[model samples]
Target: MFHKILIANRGEIALRVLRAAKELGIQTVAVHSTADAEAMHVRLADESVCIGPPPSRDSYLNIHQIVAACEITGADAVHPGYGFLSENAKFADILDAHNITFIGPRADHIRVMGDKIEAKRTAKRLGIPVVPGSDGAVTEDAEAKRIAAEIGYPVIIKASAGGGGRGMKVARNEDDIDVALATARSEAGAAFGDDAVYIEKYLEKPRHIEVQVVGDGDGRAVHLGERDCSLQRRHQKVWEEANSPALNAADRSRIGMTVANAMADLKYAGAGTIEFLYENGEFYFIEMNTRLQVEHPVTEAITGIDLVHEQIRVASGAGLSVEQKDVQFNGHAIECRINAEDPKTFAPSPGTVSHFHTPGGLGVRVDSAVFSGYKIPPYYDSLIGKLIVHGSNRVECMMRLRRALGEFVVDGIKTTLPLFQDLVNSRDIANGDYDIHWLEKYLAKADT
Candidate 1:
């Protein structure tokens, strides 16, 4: 076990890692930007160092400053808690060269899975179902048109390096292909510095389901089941539930085993998620997220497992604490992403929180970094907290989530509280009959 570790990010995730390390008798050093000198994570960590300015390029995303902080603090390992450099292969290699442990997968694994084109090919070779589209990247408009025509109409152009729905566009016909391809490449270049784009058949109103799998280094892997993340806006997930309402028990097992087999075949380690798109009872591989997802808490709620601790154990050469048969998914869990944004226009709202009142009761868990008088910064994501609820079944879970959302109170800034309140109360959500476009349609009705 590592005696000390450095956390290379900020916000609630940093605090989440800190709490876990402390429980395992490990000292934690937090590295923060100048904008987060007095942040909640910094206050809770055993020690802290200011890295750089507010801008992410000079601060959170700056690799050198984070490595220097680790050296200065004598940290034996670095735990990158999602985002920033968490999925950067070069950062993992740098830590390896410095003889410091990275509490995640191997650098090679990150490199292989980080590339969307390569991941799909690998999944196909492993016998996993993938959407029909271009074999790889399309460098010319002629090739793009050929691929789009072959795949039929209603195809999507996506960046080879893109995630979170950025650098993606849907073309319904041949006439729209040229503009869609050009726009996607430009956006990809701006966001990821790589303009490479690929084509795939777009499945309208698909359910975004992902399976969480953990590898125990020795080639053993198991799936903790799936998360239903179809409820999203701007390609960002807002609500996630465990044991997808769309999939039956047999199909769930099939998808889970398929993902586990793929991971074992690739020699993957630590924790990763194999995401898929479900449409008309068929599942197609989308991409794999190589780090802990923003929605992992819902899985933990049903499994009673500490994923952070398991990541550390795997990094330290330990095996997974549970096996496939030993893992049992019970009850239903739901999570609402509480963001600092306007419910109407969806604009970012960052400011000091005048008052904070969180819900507490059976099956309600809040993962947050804010408290009374805490100032929310504008330098990063708008996520202020996560409101999670669990119940014996889906119906109870929905009711519990509704009650919890009502109890949550944050003042002095706008939030998406009202949006979720209206969503959970809707009959569509109550019956689990919503598709990816349900929220958009719901909002349109409110406009009148």
Candidate 2:
């Protein structure tokens, strides 16, 4: 086991990793930017280091400064709690060269899975189902048009190295294809410095389902069930639930085993999510997240597994603690990503939190690092917390989530709490009869 682990991110996820380390009796070093001088994770860590200024490029993303922090603190491992450097293969390789451990997958795995184009190829090669798309990036407009025609109309153009909905454009037919391809390539260049784009058949309506798996880097892995993240806005997941309400017992087992088997073959290390778009009783792979997901709590709630703990254990050369046969899924769980944003406009809300209150009771968990008087800096993501609720079944879980959302309060800044409240009362959300486009349509209708 590592004696000390340095957390390489901030906000709720940083705090989440710190708690997990503390539980395992591992000393922790928290690295922070000047903007996060008073962050909760820094306050609670065994040691803290100020790396740089507020800008992410100068601070959180600065690899040299982070390595220096590790050296100074004698930290042997780094747990990048998502975002920033979490999926950067270069960062992982640098740590490896310095004899410091990265508590995630191998650098090669990250490198391959980080690129959407290569990830799709790898997924298909691994016997995982993937969306029908161009064999690789289409560099010319003629090729793009040809691929779209071959795949039929209503194709989507996506950046080879894109995420968070950026560098993506959909074309309903031939007339829209040229504009979609040009816009997608332009956005891809601006956002990712890569002008490469690919075409894929776009499903009119699909439920976003993802299987969670953890591997020990020794061809041993296990799946912990699946999460339905169909409720999204602008491609960002707003709400997620475990044991997807859209899938039955057979569907769950089939997909879960398939993902686990593939990870085992790949010798994937630590925690990873194989995301898919489910439609017409089939699953099509989208991409793979090489690190822990923001919505992981819901999976943890259902599986009785501590992902962070398992991540640390596996990274330390310890094989998987639980086997495939031993893994069990129980209950239904949901997670609401509470962001500091306007409920209606969804604009970022950054300010001092005057008063704060978290929902409580059986099966309700709030993962947040903010407190009353905490200043939500404008330099970071708007997500302030996650409210996760678990119950014996989906109905009970929805009821519990509704009650918990009502109890959640954060003052002196706008939040999306009201949005979640309205969603909980909606018939579509109540019945889990929503798809990837449902939230956007709902919001649009509300605007009209």
Candidate 3:
């Protein structure tokens, strides 16, 4: 293991990595912007450095400043919790240039998985099922129209390098395809600097499921389990659960093995997630997240595995501690993302917390960075914390989550707590019979 590691992100995830490193007897260094000088992760780390000002471009996203901080702190390794530069292939190359260990997958692996179109092609070569889409990227309006007609109506135009619902559009007819294609391509170029867009048949009421796999740098890989993140808003996951009600034992085994085999063949390292869209008992490959997912806590709750530790061990040239047979799924786990946002208007509400109270007791976990007098900065993500609950069964997990949400209290800021509460109590969520659009439709009927 490295003598010391630098965490390249902020908020609860940074804190999460710190806890794991501490448990493994690894020293930690935190890099923060001036805006997050007093952040919880900074306070917990053995050493902290201010990379730059509040702007992400000059701070969290600035490679030079981060490299400088690592060198200054003498951190031999860097762990990017998630988001920001976690999946940036060039950043990984830079770390390689400096001879600093990047505690994630290799740069080449990231590059292949980062491009949606390329990932699809790779999946096909591996015999993994993929949603029928256009052959590579469409360069002309006429070509996009041809692909759309072949795929039939209600197709989705997605950016080759896009995620979080950006650079995506649904076109139900020929007239809409041209305009949607053009707009999607433009937005894709602006958001991800990739104007290459692909077309695919859009599934109505699809369930988003992903398998978590941890590989030992030496071609050995094992899957933890699958997470159902179907409950989303604008394609961004809002709620996630493990042991998806949508999948069966055989289904899980098949997908899990397929992902692990693919990684093993590619000699992929560390942790990554293979995301898929499931509908009508079939799974379609979407993309692979090359870093720890925001919903990882839920997977950990059910599997009793510390993904961070596994990541560290993998990076250190140690093999995975557990094998396929040793991996067992015990219970149902759920995670609700509590963001500092107006429940009615759905806008960010950044401010100081007058009072902060988190739920406690069995099977309830709160991963947050806020406390009394802590001010939420508007320069980054609005997520304040994650409310995760586990139980022997799905029903019990749901009940505990509802109770836990009620117990959480963060004053002087608007939160989606109320909105999540309404969701847990809804009939669709209770029966676990809803799809990705469930949350959007639920909010649409609200008096707001």
Give the winner by lDDT: 2
Answer with 2 or 3, whichever has the higher TM-score.
Answer: 2
For model 3, where is the 10-residue window of minimal lDDT?
439-448
* lDDT of each residue in 1-448, candidate 2, tens digit only: 9999999999999999999999999999999999999999999999999999999999999999999999999999999999999999999999999999999999999999988999999999999999888989987878888888888989999999999999999998888988998999999999999989999999999999999999999888899999999999999999999989899989989998999999999999999999999998999999999999999999989889999999999999977789888878889999999999999999999999999999999999999999999999999999999999999999999999899998998999999999999999999988889999999999999999
Candidates' TM-scores? 0.98, 0.99, 0.98
Q: Give the runs in model 3 whose Cα sits over 4 Å from its true position.
A: none
lDDT of 1 by residue, 204-316 (tens): 88999999999976778889999999888877888899978898999999999998988888778889998899999889998988999889999999888889998999998
> What are the RMSDs of all candidates, in order?
1.1, 0.7, 1.0
Looking at model 2, how many pairs of residues clash?
0
* lDDT of candidate 3 over 1-448, digit per residue (tens): 7899999999999999999999999999999999999999999999999999999999999999999998998999999999989999999999999999999999998999999999999888877789988869987878888888887888999999999899999999888987898999999999988899999999987999999999887878899989999999888889999999988899999889998888887778999999999999999999999999999999999999999999999988776889989999999999999999998888999999999999988999999989899999999999999999999999999999989988999999999999888888888888999888888887788855
Off by over 4 Å in 1: none
User: Which run of 10 residues does model 1 get worst, by summed lDDT?
Assistant: 434-443
Highest-TM-score candidate:
2
